[model samples]
Target: MVDDLVPIFALMIPIVAILSALVVRPWLRLKERQMQASSAATAEKAAQYAAQTERLEQRVRVLERIITDRGIAVADEIDRLRDDRTTDPRPLN
Candidate 1:
């Protein structure tokens, strides 16, 4: 009787595997989509951060140039800008 059951068990194994694949395929596809979306969002955020960093670096370079220049003219220019701001009568929107 055990020998007779061996063939039956062998046939059931493939059937069970097919049924499991049918049941799990959709779940696997959904997880793959989620991972793709997460990857895209991460890339977008990294690009935004890179752009922000570049802008900050540019500003830092400008400030360094101003500080490293050998002249009282830079101080005079900064003071003039400050005075201009106080004298401006335009209403800020």
Candidate 2:
């Protein structure tokens, strides 16, 4: 009886492989698409962070110029910037 089952088992291996292939290929494609979308979102976030960083750096440069230049009244410029910010509640970018 066990010997009779050997041929059956041998045949089952290829059938199982074919069935699993049919199921797994679609799953793998779905996973690959999900990863691609995730990476694209991450890249978009990185670009946004980079732009924010650039904007902050520009603001820092402006502050440095204000503080270092002797001709401009630093206190008045600072007050003016504060007033501008309150009047136009928008990001410098």
Please provide, for model 2 over 24-79, each residue's C-alpha lDDT reduced to its tens digit, 9 standing for 90 to 100. 98999999999999999999999999999999999999878868884468778778
Tens-place lDDT digits, model 1, residues 1-93? 999999999999999999989988988999999999999999999999999999999999988887788458888888999999989999777
Cα RMSD (angstroms) for every candidate in the order listed: 4.0, 7.1
Q: Pick the candidate with the highest lDDT.
A: 1
Candidate 1: 10-residue stretch with minimal lDDT: 66-75
TM-score of each: 0.68, 0.72
- Pairs that collide in candidate 2 are none
lDDT of each: 0.93, 0.92
Error of 1 at 66 (Å): 0.6
